[model samples]
Target: MPFKTKILFLCTGNSCRSQMAEGFARALRSGDMEAYSAGVVRHGMNPLAVKAMAEAGVDISGQSSKTVDDLATKEFDWIITLCGHANENCPYFPGKARRIHAGFDDPPALAKAAATEEEALAHYRRVRDEIKAFVQGFDINAAG
Candidate 1:
């Protein structure tokens, strides 16, 4: 049998980017990658993220927002941070878990400049697609 890489996607909050990455990894790389996501601090799930992902045919609505502490016993092969904040303050993990940064824009923060609801959601959609591309092209050997 082939080995599956256990991956953890992290960010400042469990609300958007990291959640989206987790959803995409599960939907696209379930065979090779075991994916989980968490935050340095919990900020609850973002509805806009769910809506954006639903449009992309990936449902992230059922995923919850949580902190790294929630995953105390779980170990990872790769710890990927989706924001500068989480990368700067990432916790120490035991064993051979390698940490990497894959930062993406904060959708809510970007949406602050939007003029309308659709415009705001555009930010979510764009970031969702960007994250999808990143997750889809993730090269395990390169990281390993």
Candidate 2:
């Protein structure tokens, strides 16, 4: 059997966008990839992110909020940053991990300004779908 590509999705907080990307990658590309997510600072998993992912048939409720420090010893094939803060502050990897920056908006921040619960969820859903599309379209084999 071939080895699976190891990927880590990173963001400012391991709460929303990165978590969603990790969930989507795990659900959609489990055959060729192993996905993990972490943040520069842990903000705990977002409930709205869980709901948004569940709406798309992918459950991310079980995933926890983790800081990049928690994954210090692990090696990854790719380190994908899902937010500008994480991209700019990404830690160094000891091995040959390739770093890629694909910034996504902070759903929580966007939703905070929303006047209604539905409006807040709309932001979460949009970012969720966008992250899903990005994860689904990722070429695992090509990363090598």
Candidate 3:
């Protein structure tokens, strides 16, 4: 059997973007990759993120918000940063992990100034679909 690539998605908070990426990666590339997500700081899983994934038939409610420190001992084939903050502040990984920057807009931040819940959720949904598309088209073989 071919070995599955392990990937870690990082963000400032393990709330929206990173969580969405992990969910899509797992749902779309389970046979070729193992997906995990963490943040520089844990902000807990975003409810809107969970809701957005469910809309696309991927359930991410079981996933937890974790920190880079929590996965210190784990090794990954790739570490993808989903936000500028995480790309700048990512911790060292003691392995052959290749780092990639694929920054996505922060849904929570965009939603913060939203005038209504629907407007706020729109931000989450947009980012969620973007992340899903990125994950669906990820070049896992190139990581090798």
Candidate 4:
């Protein structure tokens, strides 16, 4: 059997976009790929991110916020940037890991000052759907 792909989804903050991409990657790839999300700087997992994942039938409620420093020793087959800031500031990783940029808008930033909770959640939901589409369309074999 072919080895399962391992991926790390990164963003500036481990709050919304990366978290959503992680959830969507897991939901879409399941046993085919192991996906993790982390940030350049640590921030608590966004509540709306969890809610959005839950709505998509993926439970990311227990996933903790992790920093790139925290995962420095781990290796991944692919390191995917989920935001432009992350892509710009992405650190070098030792190993044969390849890098890819798949930028997404910061849903938490959009949600933070929204006039209503519904508006915030809706933004998160839309971001979550976009992540789902990206993950589902990713061709693992193209990683090489």
Query: Candidate 3: misplaced stretches above 4 Å?
Result: none
lDDT minimum window of 10 residues, candidate 2: 135-144
Alpha-carbon RMSD, each predicted model: 1.1, 1.3, 1.3, 1.4
Residue-level lDDT tens digits of model 4 in 33-141: 8888899998898888898789889998988899998888889999999889899999999998899998888887888889998989988988888889999988877
Name every residue pair that clashes in candidate 2.
none
lDDT per model vs. reference: 0.94, 0.91, 0.91, 0.87
Query: Compared with the true structure, what per-residue lDDT tens digits does model 2 show for residues 3-86?
Result: 999999999989999899999989998988899999999999999899988999999999999998999999999999998899
- For residues 122-142, could you state the per-residue lDDT of candidate 1 as single tens digits? 999999999999999998767
**Residues 83-114 of candidate 3: C-alpha lDDT, one tens digit per residue:** 99999999999988999999899988999999
**TM per prediction:** 0.96, 0.96, 0.95, 0.93
Model 1 misplaced regions, further than 4 Å:
none
Q: Identify the leading candidate in terms of lDDT.
A: 1
Alpha carbon lDDT at 104, candidate 1: 93
Give me the overall lDDT of model 1: 0.94
lDDT-better candidate, 1 vs 4: 1
Q: Give me the runs in candidate 4 sitting further than 4 Å from their true place.
A: none
